[model samples]
Target: VKVFGEFEFWFALIKVVAIVAMIALGSSVIFFGFTNDWNPIGFSNLWQHGGFFPNGIGGMLLSLQMVLFAYVGIEMIGLSAGEAENPRKTIPMAIDSLAWRILIFYMGAILVILAIFPWNEVGQQGSPFVVMFERIGLREAAGIINFVVITAALSSCNAGIFSGGRLLYALSVNGYAPSPFAKLSKYGVPNRAVMATVAVCMTGVVLNYFVPDKAFQYVMAAVTFVGLMVWIAILLTQIQFRRSLTQSQVAELAYRTPWWPYSSWFALAFITLVVVLMGFHEDARIALVLGPCLLGVYLAMFYIVGLHRKTKLSREFK
Candidate 1:
């Protein structure tokens, strides 16, 4: 795995730079009198307009799908175990810091945005960030934010390609996908996997040119369903991985998930609730159907491709 190679390293750097720039710009606007109505817009907004649960428990519950999606990349650090300089030491250190880092970056940023603008009023005209800057009468700040969001999208796309490529490579290795996907180039990169991922992503570019509105919505729904399925798989895999371990080996886990069976169960339940919520909203309903359908297709393919037979024969021989 060319984990820290030129492409991955540059893409990560771009994301870091964009985030730091947003933070710095936001702080300057808050601290200095960089705008006309220079008010702190303190924490009080969290409760002032219809309180914290303004949208009621239903809205909050529905929002979990987006929140969980935001945290999708959290496991990327763990996936780097294969290429880490020192797996045991570095992996533990990263895991130890992961929770706090996410809380500060994801949760903290949301809090700040809510403070600056009323939660309900957000997304009324456009992005809450853009609205806040415009409220402060900083036209330039708004433009800068637009640019930042563009960079953020590019960074996200770059990461998505990288992740999808790796996933295809893994599937190939397990014989769940074609053998060509497992082939690598002289640079130690899964070139075929990279090309395949890029090709799939380019379909979006073509759709944007042809059927922009409908295509974009369909693509977004598909992506969300795919993401939800991946999360469910990960949680299920972790459960099986833990169950298969001996008691001594289980005790040796460096970064065990908290609340054990309970937390895992709760996470699964929360995901199910999100799916149920999606069914209530017309915009998200397609995802509710698509997610399970995709999973069913995967199961059918597994059986049709003789994965079970191969595994059983291998086990018998062993």
Candidate 2:
């Protein structure tokens, strides 16, 4: 896991550098249009074929479902808080950095792509990253971009395994999972939990082999739903946590979420919007239904086995 972290970090740096380069190059092309002989690469792509809102607000709304997948690993920065030596200092710094990271890496990259190519024609030309670089006459840019993308995918997989293992380890320690899953190897890795997590993930590979085309859509939607569900839980948990604290206790805290109550409320509203939008897309609706079905099973098991007592004990110990 430690080595995985190092690899993920390096690959992420590669992506950031590549994206920063793209944005810089794309900006030059847009404003100066020197590549186009000072033609002033304009918003014709945005509004020419159809207006910016060509598909209407509903189209924008539905796009959120896909967009959520892009943010799959955003929560990773804070996931290690329980084991961190200085979470109060590091966690806030991590969260604070996300604003700019999202701005430059995600939003900025999309802006460059949409501006450089017609909105509808962007995907048709191939990866905007490679296309933009190719325009600058780098034939190797496509292979490099493809390599970076492969690394990014690997990084995501590494993070997913680490997250799943840690979660099950947490549950095991709390007595919700088998006690053996909580046991760590000499290096302090939860071997049992990691193996179990990897096993579940491998099931997806097996499904893909058998189902091919249908497998990806179903799994992606399920993953998106889980991501949304986790975010909602985190927001609600934070709100409750803040509510539980006295004003003096809250003030004594080293870190606090800005805008207090409103921030939490707004997050809840935004997540609610995503859920509603999920229903608007047929493929996503599978997740909307299946998420609750899975939740119902979990709830039923929790009550049937009385995991709440163990959970309370876990919290008290923490």
Candidate 3:
């Protein structure tokens, strides 16, 4: 576990460094004209094309699917609560920083992209970052962006594996899965869980080879639904978790979600809206169906494998 955890940590570090570098370089180009072809492009381009909401309210709403995926890993900080040196203090500090960090990273990057190019053409040829660099006549900028994107993909995959592995380990420990899966390897890694995750991700590589570009987009859309499910689960978990605690305990919480039930419900509604929007877009519709289907299958397996029995035991104990 330690080795695998360290591996994931380093992978995440690489991704953060690459993104920071891209942001710094991209911002500098906008601040100072990189070449004659690209004058010091300022904020004017944001409204020059079709205005800030060129795609209108609908487009902005649709863009949330993409934006939400970028924010998926934000909750990883919360998951680290159990291991934190002082979770009460650290968790609140981390959550406190989330809003600003997201606004600066996602919104700031999008703003830069829009400022540098028309919104319609932002992702047409490729990534907006690559396009921006190429426009500036930076010889190796495209390659650099490509490299960064590769690192981003790796980081995402690594995080997914780590998260899934831990989830599976928890399930196994709770008798929801085979006990053997809960056993750690010599290096303390949840080897079985990691192997399972790697197997699923390897299928992605195969799909990439056989189906290539279109497959990736379809997979991304489908996978996004999993994100929505996870968010809903978190909200539900928090609600249940809080319900089991005393009023005093709640009041003492260092990192309480603001607005209580209202904020939770609002977030839930937003997630539902994203799902509905996915149905409107032909490419994302498959995900809407597949996501539910996958959940159904998991529930069925839970019952069939006697996990339901264990759950009943837990409830009885509670």
**Per-residue C-alpha lDDT of model 2 across residues 1-318, encoded as one tens digit per residue:** 677668878977988888887788788888888568877786567677787888988899898868888786678776778766899988888888889988988998888777777777776676777877777566687679878778777877788889898889888888887789988999989889999989998978997999897787778778888888889989999999999999899999888889989988998898789988888888788888989999999999988888866536466223
Best by lDDT: 2
TM-score of 2: 0.92
lDDT of 1 by residue, 1-318 (tens): 445356656755665664555555566555553453565445676789798787788888776666666666656675677677888899988888878877766666666677666787888898776776777767786787787677667767777777788878877876778889888788867889988999999988897989787776666656666766667778899989988999899889877888898898788777667667767666567777877887899899989988766552212110
| Residue 228 displacement (Å), model 2 | 1.2
- lDDT per model vs. reference: 0.72, 0.82, 0.76
TM-score against truth, every candidate: 0.84, 0.92, 0.87
Leading candidate by TM-score? 2
Ranking by lDDT: 2, 3, 1
Candidate 3 lDDT (Cα, 0 to 1): 0.76
lDDT of 2 at 22: 77
C-alpha RMSD in Å of predicted model 3 compared with the true structure: 3.2
**RMSD to native for every prediction?**
3.7, 2.2, 3.2
- What is the number of backbone collisions in each predicted candidate, taken in the order shown? 0, 0, 2
